[model samples]
Target: MTSCSPTLEPPSPSRIPAHHVPIIPPPPLPPGPQDLAFSPPLGSLQAPIPPPPPLPPSPPAMGTAPPHVFGLEKSQLLKEALEKAGPVPKGREDVKRLLKLRKDRFRSDLCWILFCADLPSLIQEGPQCGLVALWMAGTLLSPPSGIPLERLVQVATERGYTAQGEMFSVADMGRLAQETLDCQTELLCGGLGGPNRDLVLQHLVTGHPLLIPYDEDFNHEPCQRKGHKAHWAVSAGVLLGVQSVPSLGYTEDPELPGLFHPVPGIPCQPPLLPEEGSPGAVYLLSKQGKSWHYQLWDYNQVRDSNLQLTDFSPSRATDGRAYVVPAGGVQAGLCGQALLLRPRVSSH
Candidate 1:
């Protein structure tokens, strides 16, 4: 017991004098602008701001060739073929000849034509293999001779039809011409590999049939073929004229071109014609005869003063006049025991 107590007492002296150092409170912060009494600096509490997020990645650069050139090739080919064909001829013979020539020579001539055509440099630099066959067919028949092939190609290519700035080679032209001829023969013989017969016919009938001059300097030469100019002119005129027709709810004075004149009133029921063998609103020309005649369907309704006859005939229609029958109306007889009918209005 004495030993334990003694040891405890000594411990006090050895372990005693454990001094505690007091943590002094930080000095009062100076007043900030917002704080009336004592406030820390405005931004003191916030950690240093992080740098802003990195900007978005830039867009990838575009390749040299513009995207539209692909479709333009076909159009350019068509235009070239038309130019080579010269103006459309009146009879089928010229058209057939032009078509045959194009089928024979286009490929061989394309490279030179494109060079002269003046296509864009980008296209010229790119591979022109895709357009070879089309170019050949277009150029062989329609050679652009006087014009710089490069410039024509450039213009055609601007519409995205040809390679930009590419030069033509005679070898390439020859190969292309051969290929185009083969293809044309196949097409003419109804051997084109797809359901394209109808499409080809439609194109031949409606599309531009002239060959453009490749030589920029060459004044347009009329195709040596006959009737080409007249046919081309007529077709162009018809197209231009058709655009002038008025739609429903619009009345056009035939004298005024292209402008729409509003029709204030509703359309009246159209007049009717009489029986085929009898007198009616109009008369039909016999197949054996050269001309047509008009008859009064309702002689009472239409006075003699209102009737005016014209010599015009529908160019495309067979046997010309078509008739509409009017129910619950009086029927009359035409002269010469002929069929009486109403005059047919032209759509265009």
Candidate 2:
């Protein structure tokens, strides 16, 4: 059996042994300062040896310079930063925010309405009474008693009087007066640049009233006799007092001369009187091309000797119906003719 079986050595161990590699250490350098003296001087070398002095600092290489030190431009960097900051909001909300910021910083709400001496007095007296008086008479009336200068403004706003409504606030009144003065200034300087400019300015500055005459009597009181006459006239006068007169620019139209006709810088139309028996007639004064018309009433006549003037109320004659009064009404004293108009002053 031993002979037949070939000598088969046991199978060698399956795994090979790992080898350990040796690591060689680096050689040590000679001593520095202490060994320097032991070495031969550089001049004693075979070739003419040069002495080694101190080494200069290393210069910066061209491409190796630091980013900031290379003087890199900032435009690209700034663009990148702005891109990261993102987009901004726009339109109404942005505008509102900006307005609020400005208002808070400036304290604009605390600003007082600016007024000249004349304008302040006028505003203090209330628009219906004071401004109306000024427009009619070129001055304040009777020193403006019984009216709180401040209350007038409060009442005006309460009555729905507003600049937007064409009814002015105290501030608006001041602005208008200032504007009037400015216009006068332009006139004085002949800024209009026409031959008649000076003349026109002169008339305005002189306070010449614009007037137009009408043949019809809008006032009906002439038919009434005695004590009864003043009653209707007074009511009519009171109504006229509170009514708003149209601006010259609005009422001046040549097409409807019966209603509106421009006569130079000013125009006046005669007041029409209602017939004695007429049941409160209604007359319309309309400017051509305009949708609006003014309503005037002729009610009962009331008389005060002070009321005789065209500026007084009850308008010369009355027939218990409303009729249009010419612009600015009749002047205060024309040929001993009274204004015949009386304005009613009351809180709305």
The top-ranked prediction according to TM-score is 1
Model-by-model lDDT, in order? 0.22, 0.24
Candidate 2: tens digits of C-alpha lDDT, residues 285-318 = 1010010111122222211221232332453345
Error of 1 at 238 (Å): 18
Alpha-carbon RMSD of each model = 40.4, 44.4
lDDT tens digits, residues 1-348, model 1?
000001101011122333322222122223333313344568799565555555553432432111112223435653343334322222222222432454442222211100011111111112332232233224323444322233333333433222432212222222222333222211121111123323222222222111111111112221221111110000100011121233344443343223222344554222122222222212110000000111111111111211111111133124443322113111111000110011123369
Model 2 residue 211 lDDT score: 15
Model 1 residue 247 distance off true place after TM-score fit, in angstroms = 13
Q: Where's the lowest-lDDT run of ten residues in candidate 1?
A: 230-239
* TM, every model: 0.16, 0.16
